[model samples]
Target chain A: MLDVKAEAAEHSGAGAPGEEAPPLVVEGLGHAFGERQALRNVSFRLNRGDRTMLLGLNGAGKTTLFSLITRLYNHRSGSIRIFGFEIKDKPSEALARLGVVFQLATLDLELSVAQNLLYHAALHGLPRREAAVRLKREIERVGLTDRLREHARTLSGGQRRRVEIARALVHQPKLLLLDEPTVGLDVASRQFLLDHVRMLCNEGGIAALWATHLIDEVDSGARVIVLHHGQILAEGPVPEVIRRANASSMREAFDKLTGERSE
Target chain B: MRPIHYARCLRGIIWREALRFINQRGRFLAALVRPLVWLLIFATGFRFVLGVSIIPPYQTYIPYQVYIAPGLIGMILMFQGMQSSLSMVWDRETGSMRTLLVSPLPRWYLLTSKLIAAVIVSVLQAYVFLFIAYFWGVHPPRLGYLTVLPALILAGMMLSGLGLFLSSVIRQLENFAGVMNFVIFPMFFASSALYPLWTVKQANLKLYYICMANPFTHAVELIRFALYEKFNLEAFAVVGGSLVIFMTLAILGYDPGRGLIARRAGTE
Candidate 1:
């Protein structure tokens, strides 16, 4: 059982109808390597109708947590339930419900857009017609309809990121896990990606766990899971956590929570 | 799950790897060239001095080229396994491995899909080598040709498993060349590829047992036995036994916490 009392207080004001099953959930999760305690009894939840951005410093176990949730690597102790299924015992079924855009460019550079989509679709076991229909929508949504014939490697950084997002949605997964999706994008592209994510949560009710370290990317209203030393230092709406830390902004809250200001 | 989907996934993985190789035309040529040299040049030169024997599957005495067809096929599986696996290591270094590792599919299935694809491509390439041998006057099994399917699959599984194991542990392609030299060549030479195991006893008995210990020898033996339209029980055991060990290590090598993926070790 996770102590969500503080979290509930912060998020209780959001009138999002009911508290639907969070798209992603981590409970009492912990991990370590040799002498390094990577994650310590971490626990949190994110709803599908809500946008939750994971905030953490470098080596604060941000990627490690994402790796565990995406089932990229193993967690030492704890349970990670995505859409109500544990990753360890029911990986295939549970994982099938997940769409992930890793921090690195996972696209095969030489493959054409259509070819890449088909490959991913087949791999995810999506029906041909349904995959095609969704593929069209996703491509146009990302404004990449014209570049569908181009190779992934030839596209600009922003275009490649867009393609990665489109590729992740080809299966219409209930949960989307993005690891710092807009890291290197220019101003326009970053805004474009953020806007697309907002649409995903608002229109499709698709839950997303958007991992990032930037405060600007964390919208004023979205839930924030602040990670410090591989542990959850704070959670819930961005504004409340800032108020709790008695800080002026989310960055100030983060610095105080992680002991940076104390130092 | 419809079996067709699994079939489709298998095809997609296979197609990607194959197409990638096709895009790298130079690699394809080199893949073909390596075997051609072993068959036309090395085997041909040794054919006279190979000391012909009534090796089973060979109903009557035959030329060394005829005897080594299956071995040549074995070579294809082994090299292709290494080549794809080398790419896997490179993919990890370049950060693409993380992309596939995160796919919702079971890690084993994702890996099996890759191994299966590599096997198919290697099998097709093996057939091309077989056709060339046929034209070169090398006598191959007539009805025994059909058995090549299982033989090739078994061979592919074995080599791919080996390559997977190699990829998990070996960090860089630069270190891989040494691994190939030390592990691959000996496995190929000591096996019943160029010479029969029993014959090896006449020249060197200790060396014969070492070859017998190699799983690759069994892979070669399995293909070699199938080549003659005769079932060799020992070949079956060798191939099966190697598969067991290779798959076990392959799985362990790729294991998240203890294996290469987590440890970031070059080769396991």
Candidate 2:
């Protein structure tokens, strides 16, 4: 993949130039798991072509936020809009424009790769011929065209993740949400996956929200949202977040902002 | 999503379920063995012990294996319902159910499709058992084979619905085997699946009443009568009524807001 950091820097202004709506807008989002508040008063906007890193440590409510955005869980305390469509009120329309790669691999291990993709396309109500076309294009881009007939369980962890990414893109979503997608990957696989996703945002003009605790995943030009203890501590460009925390590096800024050492 | 979309989704679910069923050879053999054992082994020993009167479906004195064939078919489907519950638990734990639930389609549609898939598999098992029974000397009328399909379908729906209801209540997969044994054995033994109701009443009036009240008894009677091309309105009403009730309950149990699934996930 090409250098996404350079591409994002070239297209620095990720959102529309004074356009009416960005790709995603979340306002006053609050959620709770029973008595425990997983998220509170959290809000952010992801613009078209922007790569936003949802930075937080373990137990920082990152998964909860992703779950709410993806409609895995519903919240009444706040509102979320994707492409100007409210999620709760117009879920089908909102979700139609969104693609998600969960932390866990959701593929049916018993199924072949092509079968898995076809099944997802059917769920999205895509016609078989159109699904086949999209499957070809997406897998080709991910360099997995030859592995299409292989069973999902036989693939390496990174290869399966790539297939998942390709599967998410089969319907051509405008906004993508990934929750700790690189948790179990090796170093090379992590870089490859991150770069591939970043390249998708840069080339396809698709907005992305990548959630992770690792600071290294955040590019200098990417938007950063520092979440801690179920709340947003800071949100801005990488350097600005660092400057606001009076820290010299992203690691120091995360430490000072979250008030916890990154292990 | 349009009507075509719903059709495609249903097709996809059923296709996946059918493929899974076909791949599990052990499940097929186990389903076959359980009912056959009741016929070939247990029925031979107990045939003389329990005297069966001339039932409507039976013109004259019928051997125990011939009498118990339809009941054993019901038993096969009942166990199939439990098997469906096990798969549901596995889906939830493995997170594939999350994928199904996230679809734009309504939850009721997704659940109904799953129930239908289970019923189809159960009916297939019933036919397979019926086929083998012919060779084992437990033969029904030639036309009885044709009538058994509808009976098996209805019985499968009721039993699968009951299984869905149990799955909604059972939280974990590890705990399901004991629950399945508890449910299947009692449902089979307490009903007319093994012996005739009159014989039970002769032995004990209270036990006979209990057997009379058991829905499994009605299920067996519905199949048994249908196997001989006979219609039992009372059996039909009970089985059909119980099917509707259990199906509605199962659908409600899968509802995300107040359902057991939501409650368990929320607590987690």
Clashing pairs in 2: none
Clashing pairs in 1: B169-B266, B169-B267, B169-B268, B170-B266, B170-B267, B171-B266
In angstroms, give how far residue A62 of model 2 lies from its true place: 3.0
| Number of colliding residue pairs in each model | 6, 0
Off by more than 4 A, model 2: A1-21, B92-94, B202-210
Docking class of 2: acceptable
Q: Per-residue lDDT tens digits of candidate 1, residues B38-157?
A: 888887888889767786767788887777878888888898887776676576433556655655565677788888877777887888888788876776668777876788888788
C-alpha-based local distance difference test score of model 2:
0.81
Lowest summed-lDDT stretch of 10 residues in model 2 chain A?
Answer: A12-21
Chain B global fold similarity (TM-score) for predicted model 2 against the true chain B: 0.94
Give me the candidate number with maximum DockQ: 2
RMSD for each model, in Å, please? 4.6, 4.3
lDDT of 1: 0.77
